[model samples]
Target: MSGQRRTATRSEHALEDLDGAALSYAARFAEQSEGRRRDHLRDELVQLALPFAGRLARRYRGRGEPLEDLEQVARLGLVKAVDRYDPERGSFTAYAAVTITGEIKRHFRDRTWGVHVPRRLQDLTIEVSQATAVLTSELSRSPTVAELAARLETSEEDILAALESAAGYTPASLNGPVGDDGPAELGDMFGALDADLESVDDRLTVSGLLYRLPARERRILAMRFYGNYTQSDIAAEFGISQMHVSRLLSRTLTWLRQAMLTDTPPRWESTGAPPEPPDAVTVSVDRADGRVQVGIRGELDRSAAERVRCALVDVVCAAGTDEVLVDLDGVGFIDAAGIAALLASHEAARRAAVRLRIADPQPYVRRSLIVAGLAPLFT
Candidate 1:
């Protein structure tokens, strides 16, 4: 007990020394009149009082607000306190603590809540929180709602309502882990009736059909639909006849139709409009001297392939020229899908009986085309 008392005395002496240092800094800060000296003094005082602010901020940790963010808020409060503090009014520690707590409370009130809640409930929640902390200290246990109501001089119903609304302060993720060493999520505990299961059934049928296809065949489809590869490009990649690629694609598409017919695909409802396609490629057409020039920009990968293919086809088909020139000068990247898109465009140009020339491709793009055995076509 004597050793405990000695330790307590040392702690008290240490606190007193801290208070003396803070007070000295604050006096120096307040004495300077709007100069670098004043700024320097203010910095010194703020740095001195930062630990106090940090301690105040730590009170609200693990409530979803990151400790770092809370500390930032507290530091701002300390700066305000240092600027507004009057040594004549009160001790800097007490003033700074109040200011920092107010900042943290304001942070919750203004920013932390995920959903809208009433102003009265918000104020009461903060009040209840403060009362709970104080009561927990005084009683050595969490206070009951009745006890909380008594402390705050409010009804038990109001205390309960505030407690309920406390959930709005930090809305938890359904994906968050809860029980220790458990594989289940919060989402797993709940289920809602989905009226759209019929649509899901149709999608699953089509998805299963596609997934069941051979990897190479699926890749070809991806090149055609997702990668925007022409049948000719796909054929060249596989060292097969273009007619074979065309037949394979047609068979796959027919399978999709058969599955959809069996499943009775649902008509899209008007509750929401279809999403707009993303702008992954840009195309500009210039016609001059019995030739049409098409300028393409952006990465020509799987994502952009379909758009690029369509743009090339439309431009080439519409151009009443002996030669259609595709200028890929602005294109930065190209992939297998992009090569397929170009080959598809070439096929479309052939059907229209027009010459399609790939002109001024970037060095890497030209290298890719050459490697893909389409160098002669481009020249």
Candidate 2:
């Protein structure tokens, strides 16, 4: 995207003035019986059109089409525009711009913009469908962005962003509504009932819930989740810093926890979605339809130990659960309490008959467990 942006930017430089009188004189001579001047003028015009072709290509960035292909399509338009143009028509530049611009937009509408998506990103379309299925089953209500993120074991932001990316090539169109013969979308039957996720209370609860968070937090959630922005992109949008975005997002989580608790009650309480911990304890849990992965990063201070405990408990007890994977892949430090938390969670899983798996344990977490005299049990 950056490269495309740079290529487009190159077009905005100060205008290159062609000596029109000289060009027209040569063109007139070329127009006389079969001659070299017409071909030369046309070739020069094609070269001039190349930069516009590049700029138009960049505007549709992120639609999953290759830039080079779009440029070729645009150049095709430029060629057509150049062919129909007469030097006597206003400025040759203005005449060329109109026909070419229209062609570029039409080209995208037909070949790329909302039609093309790469294989990897196309797979995400399936992931979103599966996620929506899971969330609809669990949440009884339409899932919020935060809830969807929690279920997928990704940040709520990532799930929403993926949905937006998928929207561009949605195998359907938003500009057109469903058939007029049927009732409005929600009013239509979904398995004799309405499966439409947004039809739930018209998303009233989630929107109301968002109003409770701080404005900055609300903006972060909007940018990250809805607009498909990375943290860096969000940082750039607000004209602040990435660290600033990091800090703000941390605080946003704390506020979300508090607000949800105030509005709904215990449903989300005891959730792994606790207050954001310091860099001292970094935990990531990726919950998907078929499996649950729990990853812990950084040192777990004694105070931060419960964060890990509650997280393990949440997934281990989750319904339709498969396996609980403890990824100590990023753990470089640990304390006695952290070790105890793992052991307790493991035992709890045993009682429930939940499959508990620990993967590629990091050296530090391994050393801590061994020194604690618990290594023999797992081995």
lDDT of 2 by residue, 1-379 (tens): 9999886565444134433633554466456665676677667767755775667667865766777777777788778876776665567567656776777666555555465655545555557768788888887767777776776677766676677776676455434446786445533323464477656754644555553343457779988889989999998888988998887777666656565556442222222345333335666878777788888875564666888888888778872475777887666556688888888888878877887877766555677688877674442
The backbone clash count of each candidate, in order, is: 1, 2
lDDT of 1 by residue, 295-334 (tens): 9876687888998899999988898887899998877567
Regions of model 1 farther than 4 Å from truth: 1-15, 18-31, 59-64, 126-160, 174-379
The C-alpha RMSD of each candidate to the native structure, in angstroms, is 17.7, 27.0
TM-score for each candidate, following the candidate numbering: 0.36, 0.27
CA shift of 325, model 1, Å: 72
Cα lDDT for residue 42, candidate 1: 79
What lDDT does each candidate get? 0.80, 0.66
